[model samples]
Target: MKLKLRIWRQSSADAKGRMVSYELDDVSEDASFLEMLDVLNERLIAEGDDPVAFDHDCREGICGACSLVIDGQPHGPQAATTTCQLHMRKFKDGDSIDIEPWRAGAFPVIKDLVVDRSAFDRIIQAGGYISAPTGTAPDAHAVPIPKQDADAAFSAAACIGCGACVAACPNGSGMLFMGAKVAHLGLTPQGQPERATRVLGMVAAHDEAGFGGCTNTGECAAACPKEIGLDVIGRLNADFRKAAIRAA
Candidate 1:
């Protein structure tokens, strides 16, 4: 198949960016999106042109490092799919594809299709972990957790921190991301002790990192590659309210 790509090119964070078009011919329909880019980069190198830059760690879609806004949709037009998991077959021959990095004040452009997502790491560091004692390995059956709580925690833990939620939100909100982090731990026994403080700190860090506030538009949940639900956000709000009232 042949394809036309209109990709955003920025030399650096301080530099201006524009869409640069390139025509790709004989691209295999079954090739992964990143693989198609690899082919494009090889061609560019042969032509003595700078190759397009994008992030991809573990290209298996587990790492969430392959971030791309394809054709005005985060991770392409598919629901519950990351860019790395997207296949070229999703597009038709002679289709023009628009590719850009995640757009948000918190996620600054590094170069080409790569963006600095360390803001997410900062939010995680703020208190997204539990304070469990580290000693000898405890048996998995040592602590008996209720089935419902375990399921909820597992569901929330499915989030991969891909930033699709923020990219899809009109306000650039990170609520679904933050909510998943909060709920994943809050529903578990090991995470109970730090639940209140963790929610408070992560939310504060999210705001400090310049992530916009959640407006309940629900776009975040819709764009989530993992299909993490907005119910996590609802749970997070309740937890935050409880924390605030307790602090007062």
Candidate 2:
């Protein structure tokens, strides 16, 4: 396939950025999106031009590091697919693709398509884990957790922290991501001890990191590659209310 790519280019975090256009040809229909970009970069390098910089760790889509907004969509046109998994066949010949990094204050661009997502790491540090000694891995049936709770926890744990939720939200909120972490741990027995404090601390850290408040727009879930449901946000709110009341 022959394609035109209009990609965002920023020399540094403080540097001004703009869209630069390049023509890519001979892209295989089976090639993943990142592979297509790799072809483009090789051409530029061979031509003595600076290559486009984009984030990508695991091309298998498990890492969530391939954070690109393609043609105004967080991950691309496909539903529940990350940029790394999006195939060249999804586009037709002579297509013009616009690619940009996650646009949110909390995720400032470092250079080209890379953004500093360390804010997510900070939020996790605030309360995303059970600091208590877990001792050792217990038998699967040892802990008597309700099947429903276990399912919900597993669903919420699918969140990959890609920042797509924040990018898709009109208010630039990270509630869905934060809520997933909260629900994932709160529903599990191992996380019960820190449930209340976890919600409180994480919420505090989320706000401190400059993420906007969620207004229930549901864009986050729609853009989520893992399909994390909006119910986790409700659970987060409930837990926060109880935590606030207890601290009062």
Positional deviation of 170 in candidate 1, in angstroms? 0.5
Off by over 4 Å in 2: none
TM-score of 1: 0.98
Mind giving the per-residue lDDT tens digits that candidate 1 earns over 1-248? 99999999999999999999999999998999999999999999999999999999998878989899999899999888889889988989999999999999899999999999999999899989988678997999998999999999999999999999999899888999999999999998899898899999999999999999998998888888999999999999999999989988
Tell me the deviation in Å of residue 5 in model 2.
Answer: 0.7
List TM-score per model, in order. 0.98, 0.98
lDDT of 2 by residue, 120-171 (tens): 9999999999976558877889889999999999999999999999999999
lDDT score for candidate 2 against the true structure: 0.94
Model 2 residue 207 distance off true place after TM-score fit, in angstroms: 0.4
